[model samples]
Target: METKNITGLTEFILTGLTHQPEWQVPLFLLFWMIYLITIVGNFGLIALICNDPHLHIPMYLFLGNLAFVDTWLSSTVTPKMLLNFFAMSKECKIQFFSFAICVTTECFLLATMAFDRYVAICKPLLYPVIMTNRLCIWLLVLSFLGGLFHAIIHNAFLLRLTFCNSIIVHHFYCDIIPLFKISCTDPTINFLMVFIFAGSIQTFTISIVLVSYTLVLFTILKKKSLQGIRKAFSTCGAHLLSVSLYYGPLLFMYVLPGSAQENDQNMMDSLFYTVIIPFLSPIIYSLRNKKVIDSLTKMLKRNV
Candidate 1:
């Protein structure tokens, strides 16, 4: 095994969204529109939070990071998929190193955002003190660092693998699942690595979020005014929506065993996380946020 020559795979053939020739154009247009909206919505949210003074709280700070992550996350897979949709033949080479970087970064960013919410809700009195500007900046830096660390390890393992035969990946992008399917060597170690790292991150983050929300609920229930409880719940509504969208498809895709039917089902679920969720996240956050609406209204009034 040590003496085996590691030759770089030249190209990979992506099984585009659908095999049907008739569906190509329609699917292309639909995802193209979604990609455009995702970029605009996420960037708009980031700009709104950055430029507006009133939106400088920990919540909005986290929202801005989420927007930034969503922007890159969608960019990583959608553009390539869109281009493939328009192509006559779906052949592409995903630089494994580049893909490893993208996926790892996204995972860390999601975990960081979960921790931000935990701090904001669980320690409201000390939120400002605990999540100072310096601290937030450090958190962002650490998130990226965590991604870099994981990506290095993942890519290193991938580089060691010898792929001499199949190069066709049956997915829209360079995800680990599809990539593992094409590996010529035994993938038990690779599968275990993904299970340990990805699974641990998801489980730990979800636990923190659940604990934070549980405490928040208990606190809200203690308030005498129903209006206060309602208001608090409304504030958290968008976060809950985001959490569900992100975790739901993730659990479905990663936790379950891949079967013949799972391929198509997984692709659709991948669309939910990669396309629909990113596009909807900013809109959900903005619409549910009273401050964002007020700020936008004031800006429009001043411009008019």
Candidate 2:
């Protein structure tokens, strides 16, 4: 009954990643460099893949999309975070909505990439027939739509909650967990929904990746050529490292007990996925890839 007198929240005060004045400038500069590199790396990858006819295969196509997603994923949070370090704080639904979509899409895309690897390595003879262009298009569409559906479900539930008291969000961005903690309304159902949808998405995607890699492993074991086995392992190694980096923090942040996810730790985890991963992804994909390097060298020579 006493709650009737309280006013509703129109805006939120984000506490951001850190409160120390001295750390703000350095952090801002660090993330500024990261954001710039992420944009350049991802966009550069996209351009390279799109222009090179030799790279017009399922692997490069998926890598291109992954780059695109990583760009948006970093953009959605890092700018806001950079501003927040200077005590400029603002919140909006668009930021969270976009971030949610990118995160989910990336998860599905990773799984799709894993399956692509499985087909290429485990069923090398049928790789061309099995991974048709139509199938690739469908997979991409499914990832985007899956992300859209997940985002809609969470946002719908979030709209029902009331924020009466503190408008100060404990983290840099407007994340679901932090919002839940600050809401005056009971977030039991929201948390439950997260457990169902988010958990299922992560679990399902991880399973696909694991199963695909396992099959690929078995296929490699049977191969007579040691060279083929090394090549197979090398191809999968980049993706495995990427998956570990991308999913490890997410599992820790979302799947684990809520008791373990303190604000500071959660912010750090978020930073790893949202900032560090995006910057690292293109490098991971391109560093050891002879084709990408060769294409780059050719393009540079032509321009020069």
Candidate 3:
């Protein structure tokens, strides 16, 4: 028994979104359709950003990053998740790390985008100088680096602990909190690490976004340019929607540990952020931004 415990867990059985077999086909088809839309929308966003000369601004650049991140984020988890709908219990430890990296990167990207909008709206005259090519490049690099550091810290802590049995993971995708709950070790330190990282990241990013938008709002209210205010709302409004969708479920799941939360409810909340948000972001952005709409219209005409 001692030797059996010493071997540690190499693999895990993911119970997936549901334990009932009857729901398999319905969920698979549902996720498959959403995945398809996510792919098309994000790719269309990236392509529009690249092809349109008008979109060669800091705003679009960040949108391109968001689209790219969405593309990879959905791809990283959706394919495997779809497979699991039909495939039997399989090892997913490594994929869990990949998901973590993408989520961290995404958080930073959204915050950076808010900063871009703030500069554009609040400092219209100095926007060009403030968000120059060099600064944009640096900001993008920082966003990726922030994610890398986040993923490393999480893996570093988790790596130190050992698992002796292949346990069932409750959530559909790999999330830090749920994973921590099942760790064979004490996980006390890991739980603390989750709060330190998740709290700091979520709080810092949300603060930046809220502060930027608040400034923009205050500045716009004073301005007499009705057109200017309209444009600001069009762009910033979409961003706020995306931000809310991404963070709302996230806060519910991870801002604080709640033992009272049902595991199924937790998984549903995670699903909204992970799977649903990616599908909706592009639609919300394209609908709100006239430039994106014009670009789509032009492309459609050209193809026709």
Candidate 4:
């Protein structure tokens, strides 16, 4: 029997989205457009938040951080995915850290935004005091640090794995599950870390969002006026939308075992979490939130 202990594998051949040659060019065009739009929209959001004095509050501050992360996350994954789309053999390899950091950061940041929303709605009178400028800055710093810490731990364990057996990764990016599938040695420790951090941490964040929303929901329900309900939903609708777009696919991808995701579905899920969500998040905020729309309109009109 061939020993699986050999550890000299320096590269991996990513299977990308499909084996069908006919689909590559069309898919490339699609993602390329999506990437361009995401870049434009997210950067515009960050700049708008920074420049508009009325928008410089806790919510927008959190949103600016979200926008910045979304911009980089999309940039990090999509460009590389686009590059693979045109590769003649549908083969490419990328650093494991890029996907790790981007996804991990976004997870913590989303949770932090949930907390921000919680302060705004659940404790409306104390919202300003609770989410003060100093606290907001610290929260942002914590989100970044938490994400980097998760990514470092994840990649550190991953770096120890010997992938002497399979160099063909059956997915788009260097996602945790995909790497696990190809690892030659026993991935017990790696799996355990993911179980503890990815599973526990993701669950903890999702719970925070859910619990916060539950309080907001009860508050909205107690109000007899329909307008009060409308107001509540409007305040949180974009957030909920972005959360669903983010957590739905994220839970699907990471929560399950690696083998559960077949190649095609894995690629599509990667495309959604890495590419589509980043694009959709800004649009969700800008189109649905009146303040952002008003701010953007003024800026555009001024430019004109």
Please count the clashing residue pairs in each candidate, in the order shown. 0, 0, 1, 0
lDDT of 1 by residue, 146-194 (tens): 7667667766667656665567778887666777777777877877787
Give the number of the best model, judged by TM-score.
2
- State in Å the error of residue 152, model 3: 1.1
Clashes in model 1: which pairs? none
On lDDT, the candidate that comes out on top is 2
RMSD to truth, every model: 3.3, 1.7, 1.7, 2.3
User: Against the hidden reference, what TM-scores do the models get?
Assistant: 0.89, 0.96, 0.95, 0.92
The superposed Cα distance between candidate 1 and the true structure at residue 302, in angstroms, equals: 2.4
Candidate 1: clashing residue pairs, number: 0
Higher-lDDT candidate among 1 and 2? Answer: 2
Worst 10 residues of 1 by lDDT: 88-97
Ranking by TM-score: 2, 3, 4, 1
Scored by Cα lDDT, where does model 2 land? Answer: 0.90
Candidate 1, TM-score vs. the true structure?
Answer: 0.89
Give every collision pair in model 4. none
**Candidate 3 residues 168-216, lDDT tens each?**
6776766667667776678888877877888899999999999999999
